[model samples]
Target: MRRIAIIGCGGSGKTTIGRQLADQIGVPITHLDAVYYDDRWNRMDPDKFAALQEELVAADTWVIDGNYASTLPIRLKRADTVVFLDLPAMTCLWGIAQRGWKYRGGQHDSSGVYDRITWGFIKYVWGYRRDMAPRVRSLIAEYAQHADVRIVTSRRAARKMLTELKAAVH
Candidate 1:
């Protein structure tokens, strides 16, 4: 499938899955974190960020990863496939901690955002299922009605989906 959107909370393994899916499908990948944050985490102008996303979506095929909920419709409209990584909050929180440890030295992330785990980020992850999931699901229903939606709730399920995708591709 082409023109995919991988969305989830802050630490839901969106980037990791996006990368693998892009590699398997041989398409370009865009991390919206990279689009939203600039050097030193300076936020990009909302207008500019939307414009950039528009340009990216114009491409014939791509795998984009992020959950900028406000702008989700932009990507969802163009995506033929949408993957929601609906993992447990605890799993996501642990993922953030693990990612922070791995990228502690301020290494460049594929998202171009070398972000630290802040209390706010933690809270966001903790509240995602309760607060964000409904909104995202609503948006999916509204904007991506025609797209194939895959809700991945566990790591094992995700791995299985990826394995099946890879097998299909090969």
Candidate 2:
């Protein structure tokens, strides 16, 4: 798939999958966190962020990963494929812990934003399925009905999907 949009709760492996998928498909990848936050974690202006997203999606091919629900429609409208990482909250929380240890004193590989874990962030991840999934599902249904939507519920499923995708691209 060419223009893909990967969305999920924090630590749900969106960035990892996005990177691997883009590499396998030989397309440019954009981590929305990189676009939205600077190294120091300052946020970009909302209008500018939306405009930038428009520009990124207008490209011939791209794989973007993020869950900015406010701007999700833009990417959803252009995506030919949408990968939603719906892994369990505990798994996601473990992912965050692992990621934090991996990048404890440094920035995230894809975003360049420093790794800072907070109670709020943890709560958000823990409550993501309950609080965010419904809205995300609705948006996908509304905006990406024509897209190839894949919901990955477990890490094993994610690995299988990536392996199959890589094999297909080869």
Best model per lDDT: 2
Going through the candidates in order, what is the number of backbone clashes in each? Answer: 0, 0
lDDT score, candidate 1: 0.87
Tens digit of lDDT per residue, candidate 1, span 1-170? Answer: 78899999877889899999999889867888777876677888988988889999999889999998988999999999899999999999888878878888375465576766677888889999999999999999999999989899998999998887678677
Identify the leading candidate in terms of TM-score.
Answer: 2
The alpha-carbon lDDT assigned to residue 72 of candidate 2 equals: 98
Worst 10 residues of 2 by lDDT: 105-114
CA-lDDT, candidates in order: 0.87, 0.89
Worst 10 residues of 1 by lDDT: 105-114
For residues 85-105, write the lDDT of model 2, one tens digit per residue: 988899998988898899984
